[model samples]
Target chain A: MAVNELGDHLRQGHPLPCGRLVEDVFDDLDRGRIDDHGRTCVHCATARRSLTTLMEATRALVDDPAEPPPNLLDRIMQAVRAEGRRGEALPLVPIDDTGAAVVPDLGPVDISRQAVAAVVRYAADTVDGVRARSCRVTVDDADVGALRIEMTLSLRYGAGPANELVETVRARIGSALHGQVGVRAGAVDLEIVDVWPEEGP
Target chain B: MTTPDLDHIGGHPGDGPGDDRLVTQIRVAEVAAAAARSTPGVAHLQQGLWGLVQQLGAEAWTRVTGRPRPDTAGTEVAVRVDPVTGAVTVTVDVMLVVDGRRPAAVVAGDVQRRIGGAVYAAFGVAPGRVSVHITDVAVPG
Candidate 1:
């Protein structure tokens, strides 16, 4: 079987009946019979590791007595409170300088109004045929963390290349968020927002 | 003596071939390209063209250098379920075939976005994440 196919099976977590397929693909890799192909097999390796860990956890759970561990509810509640505390205390901000604006130090500014503005400003300036009119960043606070940023840009074309400008803007914004804000900027919605030809009044 | 053509010596043929994640990934890429093309504003229709371009380049390089062709395109896609989170992660290799004039990153992002959308449509479960790898570029002959 192709390594890729084996990898697929592994990724799918489909059980391979014990044999060459299992022993060669999954077990051997676990046992360190990993060949060149085996070494390169990211899929098999990940699946094997995950499966092994799960199996170990399951075994530990089953080995325990019939009665559940005491203080289970307490432990659960404790975990929940701990998580809440963690969320409350955002960890992204390493240094809380009073002078600096604290835009939710939760590991990269969730694509917010500020983040969008920053991206638009950087992108529009770098690109030849573009300028920003207004930028709006939508913050969706739900089960999933991070806000949905929507930016509207007003563009004016310069004599230079058009594509480069857009490309530069996208790259700059993407890089800034990655480098400075440390948050994953969801979608850099470039509305064209509005386009003004250079010759226009 | 030449090999006999009567019947090939092999194990159970009925067992059939195993599934290939790379091929599946390529197929997924194709599906994605098709989906993007179907979408209102998409302008290109080269499904998995990047893979082919890379394949061509590797083949050319091998012939010119008289060296064995290193397998340049080895990628796989797998959909796995997380036992703990129950979320699904669809991991695949994405070949980006950019027109020489176009930016590579733009093509890469488009492929990634389109493929993500296609996967979501194919599988009921939305993938926790989609990772794309660009293998090659396609320039006209």
Candidate 2:
């Protein structure tokens, strides 16, 4: 019997509910022999069919080496990017009882660190003459929920006084994190990594 | 092949829920995932590296074998079932890409309620902990 299933839970090292590694079951399949549990267990039965199909497909690819789709490279690169896991999970800041956030029992709401940085970068970029380069965020264990942000920025050489621009960038980031994302920025450090010419390059 | 329990839904290995509970949890995740995706301000369910890999592998298998392609891709939710007690806990720990334009709190709050409501509606059981993870914010080009 074949199953129209891919059992994502049954990965390289994942075990079947029948309490056997898929590989062990695969071994039993290769030998054309399965123990009593494997013979009767539905999960094992599904795994057996799926593995047989996979093995056949693998052998086909190895033998024929079919051409990859043109977009396969792009797809692979996208998968390689740590897009979804840009950073550690940040608990969505708790809101006061009177605040708008729906507190309690929603479980743990976490925002990706990389996503927060994007918001920070966008916030800082809004400041005139300043461009956000990179942002790194860390949470202090003692402080908890409070974040320390270190931002690298590029400034226009003639963009007014550097100090004022830096202050504006810092304020924007803090506001964005607290107001938009509901997380407080404990410390925001900005560095003028490079200064660009005012004229268009 | 039969329809995927969910294009994106899968179970945890160690907890090893029974077949019945496993199917129920997959259904809960499907409902939760759909609700979250349809919620305003959500761009798409975030696909982590591992999730992407699983999806690619699943698709590749279908393509190479000329098997029917799954109607959907991988769903990123974890469901646990207590073996002895048979208590089910749904963890909708989704990685999502939110529209950068919206307020994160409002968007996230909306996601939580929608998923919870969906699961509760379908299974008559509220997901114990719905982890709404905003993995990335998509900035308008």
Candidate 3:
């Protein structure tokens, strides 16, 4: 039965050894398990190598104590507040022409496409090394209240790696919209419009 | 609950009796833009690349036709009025100079507050919505 299971595993990629077996092999808790897999299967060998690489990368990250940019916290807080204000101030336009229309006493809450765009633009601009050029925030007509935010940004040259900067902007905008504006960003699309030239030394 | 009287408040003077003059949407936008521009820490308003293109196009048209450009063509203010309630909403996009000292959020808030006040003062109706966008931060000299 064990041989048949191994054959099935090799053929169908079904039910490989339990995670415990992989952990045991890596931790050296069961040398016999490693020997069992090391002798015949190439899949286990590949898994072991991949796991080892992941562990090394995690350790390297843990060992690095590089401090975040000093303005990160301020930028994030400002962005949250700015975006929140935009969300709260969305205008309530009258949909119908009823003379006796009862304007809900919601006390000045407004929402519009431009308001959403402003919120997204402000949030993206708050990221260090990122300058938002234009932002277009659209609502999904089919799925009412769903938001799609698109932004064009000019990243500061030499501020940081481009990928890291983009990731930070994405994470910040998502979190700000969720936490501050009480809206789930369905899609956040970023375009690098330009790379700002660094000042002369 | 009592509804506030919207007509009794100040409005534009129309041609005939019982006809209330509606405030032009451009006027509302202009008020908001002036308010924002006057706020401290707001260095200057950015026309943006698109605005620049429009301006150049307008200039070319004017030069060829020898006609003055329309006032509404290049205005930065965008205003929308509710057809039923006559409520005005304004949106302004601006760039501020932070000088690395004050927070951008605070400057933006101040601008928003000032814009609301200006619109209210001009039209006697609270703006239904005021949206401010901070596009760029200028370094202080």
DockQ of 1: 0.02
User: Model 2 over residues A53-113: C-alpha lDDT tens digits?
Assistant: 7799878767866576788777655544434353466777434324465856586677778
lDDT of 3 by residue, A1-201 (tens): 323433443454222222224444455422434566554444355445545654655465566465654774664454344343333333222111222212332122233345445556667778888988888766645545446777888998998999899888888777655433435566778889899888787
Instruction: Write the residue-wise lDDT of candidate 1 on A54-77 in tens digits.
Output: 455446555645453366466444
Candidate 3 ranges with C-alpha deviation above 4 Å:
A1-201, B1-23, B53-99
Docking class of 2: acceptable
Candidate 2 wrongly placed segments (more than 4 Å): A1-12, A49-66, A83-87, A94-101, A140-144, A193-197, B1-29, B64-74, B80-83
In candidate 2, the residue pairs with backbone N, CA or C atoms under 3 Å apart (3 or more residues apart, or in different chains) clash, namely: A4-B1, A4-B2, B7-B73, B8-B73, B8-B74, B8-B75, B9-B75
TM-score of chain B of each: 0.43, 0.72, 0.59
Residues B28-110 of candidate 3: C-alpha lDDT, one tens digit per residue:
55566677677766665444333444445445444444544433321344444344564544444443232222333444556
Candidate 2: fraction of native contacts reproduced: 0.45
For every model in order, the fraction of real contacts preserved is: 0.00, 0.45, 0.00
Q: What is candidate 3's CA lDDT for residue A157?
A: 93
What overall lDDT goes with each candidate model?
A: 0.41, 0.68, 0.51
Candidate 3 chain A, run of 10 with poorest lDDT: A93-102
DockQ of each: 0.02, 0.33, 0.01
